[model samples]
Target: MTRPPAENQELYRFSTAERWVHRTSSTLMMVAIVTAAFLYLPMLAELVGRRRLLVTVHEWAGIALPAPLLAGIFFRSLRADLRRLNRFGPQDKGWAWRAMRYGTRAAGAAGKFNAGQKLYAALIAGATLVMMGTGLLMWFPHLSSLTWRTGATFVHDWLALLVGVLVIGHVRMAMKDPEARHGMRTGRVSPAWARREHRLWAEEEAEKQAEAESAEG
Candidate 1:
């Protein structure tokens, strides 16, 4: 079967650096989650039968979870994405309300990161910080009282479950949108897909394209 033309398929969405950060962070996050499961689940813990090894791996993976995001600061495109994730404008507020009422199919002029994506990012970042703090408390029990350690363990365990669920939902949504997944993988997407999913961003991209073409001419 003939593939689509290269030009038709090409719509630069993620940069190489952005994709790298995403994949690296995701891998580390998954590693931490899996190791955490082995440590937390009784049956899994017994089956694994290496508590020390699992604990060590989980600790290091949790520590490394934020490394990719910290490295992203050096990449202008990734920084831009961070900025986009931070902003919640009138359109974004509208999108949020509509999304709640009408679901993900709700139409709105979404920018590069929609309200849902922004919320998810913020939640994940917050959860990661909480996990890091609690994990550290649990790791170095001498740093705090027994009460504090117990509280930290409770928070860490619950937060891990919540993060796991959110990550699963995020993956499900991405799977439903092959173009979005392709953009992450290949650093590009279909322009048509962008226009449909992120109209405001699509318009801005179009404007940039037009300016470049005019300058070339």
Candidate 2:
């Protein structure tokens, strides 16, 4: 069988809808984080002033954090990717073990999202839900007991710190991987990069392409 031209071989890693959803969610999360820092840090809060404004922005950002993902439910590509993120297979376990053992160097043959990416996605999702829930209680103190409100504040403060670290680490990793960053930015990646970073997913894509071509012929 004849292969397609090299120019036509770029693999689609993310769809437009997927990119938009990610961009939206990331922006909101960043806004929430920044505003939270201004609200919590005494020196920064004193310099920034406008406590009410910061609080409003932080609350709204938190409230709208899930909007993009909820809206993305209508997009088939995003839904498919969500399903992929939700599953854990044998390869995922192998990938996870290597990641734990060797840190970032353990990147090997894996699906579209390796175990680390999947774990990050899961953590972000859970953290978002927790943040929103705790945030809502704080925003409306009348909605909960004093004990509940105190507990929410404690959980919210600690989780915010954890998420800040996670986001910074995520950004640093992306900065080190230009091709992976390009895939997210442009929704496509060079076939060579895809093959090197996600061999199993690259092979699956090639198989699908071949099957489509055969049907056409």
Give each model's whole-structure lDDT.
Answer: 0.87, 0.87
Q: Give TM per candidate.
A: 0.92, 0.94
lDDT of 1 by residue, 171-209 (tens): 999999888888899988777787778877877877777
Q: How close is candidate 2 to the true structure, as a TM-score?
A: 0.94
Cα lDDT for residue 214, model 1?
A: 71
Ten residues in sequence with the least summed lDDT for candidate 2:
1-10
